[model samples]
Target: MSAPTTHRSAEEIGRTLAGPRPLPPLGATREVPLPEVVTETLPSGLRVLAVHRPGVPMVEMRLRVPFAAPGSVADPAFTARAELLSSAMLTGTATHDRVGIDDELAGVGAELGVAVDPERLLVHGSGLAEGLPTVLDVLADVLTGATYPEPELLRERERLVERISVARAQPRTVAREALQRKRFGDHPIALEMPSGEAVAAVDPGEVRALHAEGVMPRGSTLVLVGELDPAEAIAAVGKVLGGWTGAAQARELGPPPVTAAGPLELVHRPGSVQSQLRLTAPALRRDEEGYAAYQLANLVFGGYFSSRWMENVREDKGYTYGAHSGTEFVPGGAVLGVETDVASDVTAAALLETRYELGRMVAVPPTADEIEAARRYAVGSLLISLDSQGGLASTLAALDAAGLSIDWLRERPVRLEAVTPEQVAEAALEYFAPERFTGVVVGDAEVIGPRLRALGGVE
Candidate 1:
């Protein structure tokens, strides 16, 4: 084996990797305009949005059921019920066995999936236009009449238990879970993982009961069907789901209370060489005033690869591979976050630089050129995000679920274009507060602990 292929020296490797390449000039801008699409809403409260591109023979349907998380009832078993109910939907239904359902979908070249988030359960599927009826039929069966097989439910619960255990082994996942727990406190948003004991303790009856109550069609649903004949699509949905009736009123849960612990939170991970850092506070929802301005500010800071955070933290200082910031806009306001991994030795320096960059943005407004470039980038990116049928369906579904008007698709670009630099600066100053922010670092407790302590007290 040729002496097991001896390893090369670090200096030799470095020399071999040294090469230069051309790069795009700084502050260069590219502008692309997006096509405005039309939207319509049916009498049954189903929203339809379409982009008339004549190529694909497929339609994508996404049905969103709100209240996938716990309501204001404060039931301790709400999380468990939501999880078990969502999982059981995939196992089987009353009319079709698991194998039969899989074979049926494969025969028609259709796909169906269910996803559970903090706010909703989404049932999405796609098929060729000719196969849409069959796909819808299968989806309706699964969503309306899922039978929680006792044996399969037990098996899935075991699998999820093992998966949660595996997630515990990852430092980043553990740290984020911890941060959410501390930040959200008793709110349902903080419940990231369902316990193994809880999953096992949940019975089939509980899952069925939660599904019946929470998955009703009255105030609990928003349907989006894209790239199909609107009349036919709506008729098909109404014909199938009209009989599906329940009277559970949609509970309006208030926004999560604002809580801030400061700029530095250190989660100790033994024997770690680098620190994982997350800095965030509260920010505006998607429908709030200055939402567009907040987005533009984040884009100028860390939303894009060429944004300030990446330029300073990665390209200029070489403290990390990459760094970016983003906001999670739900029913409540939340601040943007800049997340990065840096060497344990330079963790404090990196944190200081991050704070300085944020402060600078607040002090000096972005130039007109920077503001326009950011706007162009944001508009172009949003266009690309809604390019596909499934993408269109998802975007509209999200908007409708959030109670926005159907004209949001046409109004988005105008809103983005009208954002001013002053607005961006003001929004950043109001939202991004380094003093009130929480910074959680997961790394070698022995090394990072001292560094964080020197900078400020780490919580």
Candidate 2:
């Protein structure tokens, strides 16, 4: 068939597309009931939280033990000891060698791994629901009886030192380390890991001692998510871990102040060809009244690909491949930041545009359409994240760590929907103002430094 000739004008088509069309009414929000969660504080002060999700045949378990060393984070020995301890915890225990532990995990089609940051040592285990008992038993064994065998510890220590070396050589890692030190100074919450030499100095005895002193269940939280009875899970946990005893309370690094204030902090990487830019500031807790508005504001700024910041930096100017901004929670507070990498030639221009976007968001409130789009994206992401077993498990663990409950999560859609354009603008004014941000730019000092210093924000 022959096509008919088009007679519609471009303006007419544009107007028709821009006009609102009738749409179906939205259905009432389907509220998923909170899972049956059983929480108990055992005699040893371990807080065990179990939830029965009842869909998938598998289970997810997470144990967060407060492993903060008593010494300052600035102490190389302290950082080294904590890192080696986490790496060695699951290498062996009293009765199980490394291979034996792997065999037990494989028997149940499960895997357990341990990781640590400044605040806690996290043991993550997952398996089929039928293997819950085995999972718990193995976890208990590692928690209470890890031996940190010398050969395994030494091998892991060497591997970690090598990894640290590799990480330090990367530009992003260098920028991150500089940002951490600039933001927190010598505070324990600074993101610096131990040096390679420090890791080499960590002996097996130190790992064992650190585990004995810091890897206690008292004040720790254990979250289990799976297709099982919550009561039964709790009982299983108690039977396995209840007798474990410790007197130390969880160490809280409430919130680190944004120490890299005043001008932008420049970490000079001589003869570099690119720059990593970080703009950061302290933010509010997730449960704060302003959180929803703040969330929307961040989305409108750079939290997603289609945001104004991304459009400005990546699409319009071609300054960078990607740009993003997001928030991370601490015990009682949050840190909000923007990150991007740019070629050395465009580094100053990109930084200027970033600040301009920050100022624009504060000065000119987002349009109604912008507000609705941002709000929907934020709320939809949250709901979608909890739709899977692993997602729900992680959500529960994270919120619990923040002292929030599942009910708070359930209520977030309404809260996000309630946020008005004005609220977002207000949040932008408060949290995203250019002056609220302290930054670090890692690049060729000769190329970007004078331009940055001339911009007046670089010290």
Expressed as tens digits, the lDDT of each residue in 1-459 for candidate 2 is 999887977656556565844557554343545675788887788888888888889999888877665654456688888888878888998999999999999899899988888778888878999998898888888888999899999899999999999988899998988877877777777755889998998878878888877877777899988888888888888898765777877665545654444678888888889999998888878888898898988999999988999999999999999999999776557788799999999998999999999999988878888888887677677778888778888788888887888888778877877778888888989998888888799998988988888888897
lDDT of 1 by residue, 14-93 (tens): 55445543455554223323333445444444444444433587777777766645554234467766776776687888
Whole-model lDDT per candidate: 0.71, 0.83
Judged by lDDT against the true structure, how good is candidate 1?
0.71
List TM-scores for all candidates, in order.
Answer: 0.86, 0.93
RMSD in Å for candidate 1, one decimal? 9.0
Model 1 stretches with alpha carbons more than 4 Å out: 1-54, 68-76, 250-253, 261-263
* The candidate that achieves the highest lDDT relative to the unseen native structure: 2
Per model, how many backbone clashes are there? 8, 0
lDDT of 2: 0.83
Lowest-scoring 10 consecutive residues by lDDT in candidate 2? 25-34
Q: How far is 184's C-alpha from truth in model 2 (Å)?
A: 1.1
